[model samples]
Target chain A: MIMTTTAQATKTAPTTTPARSIARLLLHGGTVFALLALIVFFFAMRPDVFLTFVNVKNILFQVSILAIIAGAQTVVMVVGDFDLSVGATSSLAGAVAASLMLTGVPIAIAITVALGVGLLVGLVNGILIAVVNLSAFVATLATMTSVVGLAYLVTAGTTLFDLPDGFNNLGQGRLLNIPLPVYFAIVISFILWGALRFTTIGRRWHAIGGNVEVSRLSGVNVRRARLLAFTIAGLVSAIGGILLAARLGSASAVQGGDNMMFSVAAVFLGMTVIKSGASNLGGTMIGVAIIGVMSNGLNILGVNAYVQQVVTGLIIIAAVTLSSLKTRQR
Target chain B: MRIKFKIAALAAATALSLSGCAASASSSDNGKPLKVIAFTSGNQTPVGAWWVKAVTSKAKDLGWDLTMIQGDFDFQKMNPAVESAIGRGADVILDGYTDIASIGSIVSAAKDANIPIFAMDSSTKETDGFAVNITTNQQQIADATVGALAKTLGDLKGKTVMVIGHDPHPGIRMRADLAKKALIAAGATIAGDDIQKVKSPASGRTEALALVADYLSAHPNGLDGVWVGWDDAALGASKALSEAHSNAKVTGVDATSEAIAQIKAGGNFLATIEQPWPKILDKLVQNVSAYQKDRTLPKTKFEADDTTLVDSSNAANITPSDKLG
Candidate 1:
């Protein structure tokens, strides 16, 4: 039986291997190459401004929020599940935190509540998918719509501003002259990387993602693993929202929602790197960086914002397609 | 038991009829506490918040209960808010109409409910049968900015002046158009191709830096002067100049606190048009109160006070900070 299965796999592998190889190259290599080329182009276009340390710092600071949100998104997508509501969850958390702070809630307590709200949102998503047996896509999409509606209800269609000084530091504060948000992203990514690589729960998520029935039969407790994955995703998303609120010094109902689709695109693109079709933390980080770089570089190049959105969407599609091709090749 | 059932049915019918009559009477009443509903299109941004503050504070003073509804700038939320207010027998409704197209339906609904609607901040020249439309005079703002820029540029008529302004919003577009006309009249060669129209401040600083850098690199001598349509844009442009070491004179309308600070800091920002929010609020209250006293008062159009030019020379004379509403 093993011989027969191997022979069948070998026969199918030849056609798929080339595609996978190409996909891997495009997903992993394309962004770096594009970024380098953009840098060169901008340097030539505006030598004084584009090649400066101040500009680089500015770029990183600008993309820090996207990186944080995209990193959280990467974790969720690893188990072959998507959380559409992450953006709304982020917005809701930020708005709620800002509102609480306005009401004289201590920054720490406000942040805790904001994060708690995110976890609760995640729990709902996990229950809907793992316990109630709903499709991840449908469950998350519903949550996204509901969460956005809830944010509007909370704010009554107004922005929450005049945030406490301490809250602003999370986004603006720098350690050793580096932005606090950048550090926050690094810490979160490392924690996620460690958990996914070293923990049994993380291994179980991958196992269930690869084959639910087999994992279940092998005693993986698939439902629980999926639930845990979703819960973690929610927590991370909430953190992303809080960071955003700090950065902007205010929170509006739809502030985080604008970047939701972009973060998901990054996750999809991330799947094409390192381990094609497998959501690896390293690949996701790279994916986030690529998106950040593109946005930052384009803004530095004076590209129109409308045109920037178009370019971002196209790059994501190209990256994902390349990754799929590489996987097929292998 | 059968007689009791008949009497009970008759009582129920009478109650329903009486309630319906009372609703219609309240809806049409001239002196009955006329329900006034106000709808805004965003969870309060500065502009929306200021409007809310002004209207609600006036409502308190008038001893009126104003129903304020918020919409997330999406028509889905806005439509429901408008419908709910009309349903609640709102006799007079104040709305900041974000979309011009939605005004027709809103106007129709208010008319059907025998309500008079007043729109603030946003205006529809095509709107008919509305009580009054209150908005900032874009021309006056443009004139103020252009006059200031011309004064600063003085005799550099043929020099290329870059106009940085948002073009998507109708109000912004109107200001830009008026500014363009004024620049042409002043004999200044307005560089249309070099014009940078930014949508938001999310990446405003970066965009400003890049545009300024590119313009300086390309032109070598830098722009003669920059005219921004709004205060925030001016702030971004000012940062770009500071970074590029270019001494381009910058002028902007909407004298926000930050803009005033930049002017005070001795940046090349020559002047800013400060819209007197207090005057605007006072006018809004006056018009609202007048309408309340006489429902048949003709629709009035009035321009609020002009922009207060704040250049480095007279920056000290202006109030350092004023609450917007």
Candidate 2:
């Protein structure tokens, strides 16, 4: 009986290997394939405009701020926690920076204070979850609401305009004809990717997310790691908010709050590519790119905004479903 | 000793209760200041901010005990605050820059409390919830803006234009539809065969910039004119045209400071419509003060004020709407 079973297993191994390889390819390459397909499809539809250099640059420029915020989200998500306050933090930080400048505070000082605010919000979130034992969702949600209220208070329930030109240059200025925010997005994405891929702290965060008990057994400071994750997310989100205010030449109390949902969507779209199904910076960037392409392509084709929104919803669902199925298979 | 302490506490409580009743009774007396509940969900917009400042100043001048509520576009927060204020008792309410549809429950609550509610730009057509709804005539505004665009383009026949709008805003929705119809009737083709709807007012500038830039990328000479529902988005469209070096003249409503500056600078911003918000507020205040003097309501349930067309000729003369306060 043992000999016969061994013979049969060997007989199936050859055929099953190819099948598994195909499945793996489909699971890991789905987002990339979709992104490529979208580009090709849009290019075919509008041969005169879709793949042009200017349009591509426009897509990058449009997604830059989202990329920064989404990158911040990816950091928190990797540690098996969500920073729901990112968007609110962004709005508050931007409003603070702008309000400070209006009140005659030096631009650099104002920006530093705004970043400090973001860090402070993150620390509070960290303490709530890591030290106080509150669930991440509840803790961040509470902070998000409070932060938004603070944003309204800071701006006096209005949009803040007439920011200094020197500060606006940070958002609007160009390097060789490309917008400055785009460079910030690229640089920040790279730094996040590197940190996640290499540092010991990054490894510990991944371990804690994978299994907290095992991570603790392995001597990792699980609480401190999680706290660090929330703190980093807050700081990065603040950077994104400041850039957004500069880019728009104005800041409203709820302006950066709109980025929250899109950041989550981008992160979810990005998670499909990793075999481990872990949230990753590369995947998030790809996710952000997919959204930017879809929106830009649809607009170029003159599709209705409502219909475009629906299509985006469907794409996110499909990508997430694929990732979920792959995880279940594992 | 405990019984004596309790008796003293009871006496103190009774004295405080009497004082509270006296304060409450004074607010309702005919000779006292008019207790007003003023609120809006759109306090973040430029016009909405203007309304807030203007109403506060007006209330102070009128010596009305005002309970100002800033919704910041959150109905969940604004509604409850308004309801609580109503529960506390008020002589009248002022709904500024908030759509009636969003304040239905608040209106019903105010009605139950027997308080009259006055509104400014709450709806395109007069709705039943408000005692008086005064807004700019969206159709007339569209007519004037489209005419300006046509004149700038020298002719509308065979010209291509884009009408951008946000549907959630009643006034913008109505005027955008009217503008599209007027554009087509004048033989101009609507770009993409429809209006480009913006998802959020907060991000209107970037979205508008992308729309114009992408459309121009595909059709280098295809766009001749753009009519945006608001100035923020129109300024974005103008910026895109400048970048593309396209002579596509843009028209916007709400002659904002940025739009006025652009118009004066002689770029693609052709004209903007300045709704008489200050004038409308003045009229609403007069009626409210009259009602405070004696129980009275406006003669009409709804009123649409005439809007001015601020082209380069008048752009310099008109005060920007953001600074209207």
TM-score of chain B of 1: 0.82
User: Per-residue error at B52 for model 2, in Å?
Assistant: 3.5
DockQ, prediction 2: 0.43
For model 2, residues A45-152, the per-residue Cα lDDT tens digits are: 998888888888888888999999999999989988888999999998999999999999999999999999999999999999888989999999999989988998
The C-alpha TM-scores of every prediction are 0.72, 0.88
Stretches of model 2 off by over 4 angstroms after superposition: A1-24, A100-110, A164-166, B1-33, B80-90, B110-114
Model 1, residue B176: distance off in Å is 4.1
Q: Model 1, which residues run further than 4 Å from truth?
A: A1-54, A88-129, A132-180, A242-256, A323-330, B1-38, B46-69, B80-93, B97-99, B108-116, B124-131, B145-168, B176-195, B198-325
Report i-RMS for every model.
Answer: 5.7, 2.2
Residue-pair clashes per candidate, as listed? Answer: 23, 1
List per-prediction Cα lDDT, in the order shown.
0.71, 0.89
TM-score of chain B, candidates 1 onward in order: 0.82, 0.90
User: Residue-wise lDDT of candidate 2 within B242-271, one digit each (tens)?
Assistant: 777899999999988878878888989999
lDDT of 2: 0.89
Worst 10 residues of 2 chain A by lDDT: A13-22
lDDT of 1 by residue, B179-240 (tens): 87788788887653435677554334334544554555445555777787766567557755
